[model samples]
Target: MGPEWIVVGIIAVAVLFGAKKIPDIARNVGRAQG
Candidate 1:
């Protein structure tokens, strides 16, 4: 989609998990895929 949609998705994730945990959540997700 567009850049606007990308930003919205990021915001949604941040809201769902809170800013402090986003990086940790991303790391866990990457490890799971790997």
Candidate 2:
């Protein structure tokens, strides 16, 4: 994809999950992968 798509995806994630929730989401993702 393009840089514009990346920006849209980030914004969508922030809107759907909230800015404060991202770190917790990442932590869970990492734990799952481990």
Per-prediction TM-score:
0.62, 0.62
Compute the lDDT of residue 30 as modeled in candidate 2: 95
Report the Cα lDDT for candidate 1: 0.94
> How many residue pairs of model 1 clash at the backbone?
0
Q: Choose the strongest candidate by lDDT.
A: 1
- Please give the lDDT score at residue 28 for candidate 2: 93
The runs of at least 3 residues in candidate 1 whose Cα sits more than 4 Å from the true structure, single-residue gaps closed, are 29-34
When superposed on Cα atoms, how far off is each prediction in RMSD?
1.6, 1.9
Candidate 1 per-residue C-alpha lDDT over 1-34 given as tens digits, one digit per residue, 9 for 90 to 100: 8899989998999998899999999899899999
Candidate 1 residue pairs that clash: none
Poorly placed runs, candidate 2 (over 4 Å) = 1-8
In terms of lDDT, the poorest run of 10 residues in model 1 is: 1-10
lDDT (C-alpha, whole model) for all candidates = 0.94, 0.93
